[model samples]
Target: MPLTLPSFHSMQHQQDFFCLSPSDSTMTENDFFKIRPYHNTKKQMPVLAKSRRGMRPMRSSTTSTASQKNRKLRYYSTLPVSKPAITMNHSFHQQGPKKDFISLLPYEVASQIVSYLDLSSLCQASTVSRSWYSISRSNEIWRHLASRWSLNIPQHIYPHQLDWYHLYKQRHILNNRWENGRVATHYLMGHIDSVYCLQFDKQKIITGSRDRTIKFWDLSTYQCVQTLYGHEGSVLCLSYNDHIMVSGSSDTTLIVWNMKTLQPIMRLRGHSAGVLDVCFDDRFIISCSKDKTIRIWDINNGRLLRTIFAHQGPVNAIQLQGNKLVSASGDALIKMWDIMTGECLHKYAGHTRGLACVRYDGTKIVSGSNDKTIKVWDAESGYCLMSCEGHTDLVRTLSFDKDRIVSASYDQSIRVWDIKTGACLLNFQSGHTSWVFDVHFDSTRIVSASQDQRVLVMDFTTGLDTQFL
Candidate 1:
């Protein structure tokens, strides 16, 4: 070079005379620039010199502090980013895991689901948990299930308090017992003559016999406890509710008795001929007689209310529901009447021969005829819905529900038929040795009384023809 210049890196620990004093530490390039410049210090600067080879570099205290600060910054820069903190007050934190979907479903949806299950499956589900038990034991659920089998809880009983599962089981077992021909038979042999009509409740079996007396027998012991003697002729028919017993007699009178005391309350004498059948409710008493007339009586005062000349022949059977009454007559006609106004509303006339027995379920009129056929009629329209033909002889007594009709015939057989289709489902002949006089049924078993002086109870649970023998 033409002029000698001081080298910036060649001087060690040099300070300008006119500038502020530096700290007792190595100076950085940035720190050196921050000092005030001195113009007169050029001459004091060290002369330019050639650098020696392999010389060690000078260290500064500021380098370590700066490096420490830089290291901290670099360490922070390499760390992963953090998300926002979630508070414990969130719903997810409070509820933990989600609840079961079925348990969370609405009650209506749950009940509909439970309704689809059969009795066995529903019983099994009741043991799953408390929630399931509550749903399974609901009265609506059990009521629907009971309805499927045509089992109705009595109107006086509370469905919620009843054990539906046990009730169903008992019915099933009783039906099985009937199918297998295993029965607990009680002879009930107090009557001196044939028992013409019988009725029972939970406590007693009341029978009206040709012996001209009404006998009250204990259901459990099968022992006749009391005999009500008033009718001069044979007792032909009997009907009872919880508090009162009404009996029709060949003496041409109908007697109302106190069911508890077995004492006569009133003796209604208006029928010119023997009273064939009698039915009553809380308000009125109805009687059909061999005189071909239907009479309505005031239950309280024993006063005759109205009378209708219903048929040309004797009225053999009668049933009362609400304000209407249905009477089957030996005239081969079935008439539905308004008891209050003494008017015939509908007349069902299809049987070729006189009807022997009849039953009305408020909608359909079922009549068994001496024509050896059972006719089902529409009570409102007077149309013959179906004619069930199977009995070789006259069909005498029968009972029906929503599905099937169980009939007892003078042919000494009990037959089951589909109510809708009129197809014979099962024929039971071996059980009765003589004409089956009267038959009654619930949801499970058929109890039939026969002219053989025997009562046959048959199970309908299996509904198998092979079991009917």
Candidate 2:
């Protein structure tokens, strides 16, 4: 059967059916071919393919292409031209001014069609013409991509702002550098004794050391801005939030300092032994000690809240997640506790020797042990997921973000591992000359403390975009 074309006696109605404007009433067969729905073609083409208005119909070079084009022209030849003055019996078509395919469609409809393109294809399409360029850089296109990574972008979520696309570009380049182990290393060296524990945010780094004091370092300058003297013994652990910073000491005392003023507010001396680890959320200060106990303290006045003779041996580390607490101990076990009810929610046992450090994100738990191995555990079922083995001595401290884990050990080495696969990503054995005591990281850098009395910073953010980080 011959292909039947819609009668164009009424051009106004026929134009709507083809998604065309009034000016296209005199369109030619070539225009009709361009307007045809490309059934087999993908919405996104190869980034290298050049086109016009980003809506140029893809041309196929297959054996069937000759027949397809012939069929399209044949179909167009039979359709009547919608001319107001021309007679219906005219034999050949009389074409008017030619119109490009993109201009012929409603802009919103055209934009929706091109939104399927990935960033690379969109960029290539922008060079085709002004209309394609406008659509390619539109805020809507970039915003959709931003939402895929996360919707919490810092600024310019509204249209007409171009930072969303810029952020997307920066993150990809930074990730590639991290996977390739490309980074710069900086050192901080003022502690009189070994650096023991550390934490940092965007502006500054806070570290506790065996020097019997806690020090604050400016992140940008990498210099010690201030040092506070309160602990009579080595400061072993620390934790802080927006309002207060707390440091625990081998003096068996914990001191709370006002974050804004950096002045000591209260000192609670109750633990009979050295405080080994400390952590807190918004409401409670939780600390574990060498006395084989975990104590919860009121964050405001240093009031003793509750105590759980937490483990069978010295508690090595503790982390707080909302109302739940997880503690690792020398008894070679990890226990999750309900903060309010004081009930043991679960227990994880796998390491052959005692645990030295642990970190969790509520779903997954990563623990380092004297057994010389790191274990990843399913937080829900207490089952071991993967055992990462590389350290030659006791794994002393560990930390993790969403993508990878950074661990330090008595072997005088630091190792980075993929959080999901347990494969070692990077190893740095020369940064410290003694046991590494603490480790932490953010999106752009890894910070570690060691018994060598020095802090090493492996920074991957140089010359890369880390605005979102």
Candidate 3:
């Protein structure tokens, strides 16, 4: 028969008698041990096999065996242990202290090592020791972590009182909320027609609409702060900086405005067809048009510097960096041009249909096409590196930074993508009720314009400070 555990009372009574009267020399080793019941309430006592010595002779203080001459059994026993608990005490008295070499390293080296740890691991490490706490909470380490994540955390913020880890924690929360769609959605409602173009910074949002008026909005209050009327037809595109603003319109004209006073600086006229897009920097204002031409103009005056026959069809979008210009055209081609000499450097072609928007950051080019795919191109080799596909309709507008591509589509959706992996990280479809025309984002929020006649701001940093942008 299989061995079974007896009741606590019965087993104790039998074990007390067995230990006191046991001297069976002929008993097998298995017969020498007795299964005794103990008082632990977590589980029933188990049947343990015997040892070779009689009654499994244990050290005892209160009792002894009469027949076995001091051989004893622990009737009210505890669990067995080969070692004592004193050896495993948390004081670690038996083991020497381990030197924390990582914590003793120079600040730069320590920061680099801790940077490999994710936020959770870093937080846990901070509590491990005083030396680690000091190393993990260093401002330099937290600042590096923020930059490594490619977040737009503000620099020179409260130089004396700044806490980089706290700043990163808040920004990380905002970024996580963005991926999870936990944003506060608000609309800038002053535009009477479809909002077609938009750009923003820390202070305000500038939007152009089919109503032929450009409205400037205070981002904090979501209220229109100013309006400018200079275009006869619908405003199509615009770009601006701290000092200057340039806008393009279906009237076949480009206007330069003094951003300080929000007044017209000059009117530019060159394209035969409607001007589609405009961008400017410290030196030049670049514009593209339905006339299939790219025009370079003086930033201070309305004088046209040079015009290049850019593509076979309407140049739908154009972006400028240092001395190069990248234009996406209705002919399903993307071309890079020299702003100084008006020369075509290279042409990139992969889209099966016309291209709608393009962004160039000197080293790479990203373009959205009517074929519903976004392609990343190597600026130096004219090679298509990766293609991101998700939108079911024309990928009309897109903006990107070092990490993410925020693209809006005629499918009435805005998709956020990982720039390096081509992963579609977020798909926001409820913000707009009609075709989305433009989408832009910083680290905190995604602002988009749509044909629904409203400009939506999805603020991922709803309850957090946006001082960093």
Candidate 4:
């Protein structure tokens, strides 16, 4: 008789009966079946016996009488009586290799990879795996990211307790809030006349007015807590650091105030005409006046250290950084001066009309003028980098950071520009109903005070409808 063979369906059912060998720890029963060997009655029984050693034999409890008969007949007819029973060992089955390239990398290498991604990309990567989530939340990675954007984390925060990821998210949310124009506006009204200049830190907003008074506002309550009265004429400009403030006025004097007590600490009298602008550091107080001179004074003794004939016209604005100062004058000139020596280091003469406002970081100088144009200059070379034009009237106030410049104008508009290319990024026309007199910004928001007697706060990221008081 011809050799009997099990049907294909019967063979599949029998394959499931192969017992998993506990001794064969390398692979599993499912893995064994993935590359199962084919069997035939005509093949040598010795070769089949050798291969079967890798798997253990298992009897099927569910085999019916007819299935058992078929299995017995097929096995008895296919193998010689002298052959020993074959056992299946699952250890011979090979498993597919792991694909965890990211997890396999060293911790430093993994964090470095995450640092290259932006905030949005880094956030998405955190969801990839548990290991990846931990690596992406590393504080060093986020701190480096914050520094890249020039976003300073508050100094009051404990070093080990800083949450860089949350800090970045908060700024991102605020930026979106401004870009979408969704914000809550609080009106701070106290001055009976036009507000001229303002400075703020984390706790309070200090503003000067043509009403000859300086008001200190509680940022949380939006209420005027203290009104400083001493200046005989309209207070034109102001600067503050730590808990000390320096205010210059049309009275031709500069008063240093203890901001915590809201009282005048000392008064320095030297300017012969209206003081246009003032700034101070820890040791020196500097002021520019309509008298066409810039004076540096010793803050401790209230004595004039030196004076430079700074301009042919009134110096309207001045910014001090360390030992250097930049002044803008009505003669349409922007000059960089060494405060210690009273020597002019560089002069930028690009604006066609008198410069109304000016700011300088160590690297670049930005000036807005009565000619309705804004110019950016290279501080080191005294060369004009770019001229930004858009406002239909005089640009009155300006503020900037590493990436952008924000300007307020008499045209009743506030515009944001890309610092490098000098292209207008945003134009905020509906926020103010009259000339915007002063503006200040940080990484997230822009706040402007207007002649309309209103203060408008805008979110940087969202361009939503403007809210007003």
> How do all models score by TM-score?
0.65, 0.74, 0.74, 0.70
- For candidate 2, the C-alpha RMSD (Å) to the true structure equals 15.7
> lDDT tens digits, residues 253-348, model 1?
998988777788999999999999999998999999999999999999899998899999999999999999999999999998988888889888
- Cα-based lDDT for every prediction: 0.73, 0.78, 0.79, 0.76
What TM-score would you give candidate 2 relative to the actual structure?
0.74
Q: How well does model 4 score by local distance difference test? A: 0.76
In model 1, pairs of residues that clash are: 178-459
Which lDDT tens digits does candidate 3 get at residues 57-85? 35443332363432222321243665453
TM-score of 4: 0.70
**Can you list the residue pairs that collide in candidate 3?**
none
TM-score of 1: 0.65
Looking at candidate 2, the ten consecutive residues that score lowest on lDDT are 1-10
Model 4, which residues run further than 4 Å from truth?
1-147, 151-160, 178-182, 459-469
Worst 10 contiguous positions by lDDT, candidate 4 = 2-11
* Candidates by lDDT, descending order: 3, 2, 4, 1
lDDT of 4 by residue, 1-469 (tens): 1111111111123342122122122322223222222222242322222235667654344323566566666776688768986653343233476576778999899898888976546655665666776787788887676554445546676645776654554454444443434445557888888888888755678888888998888876878988999899988889987778899999999999886787899998999999989988888999999999999999888899999999999999999888899999999999999998888998898789999999998889999999999999999999899999998999999999888899999998888888889888778777777899999987546678888876665533332111210
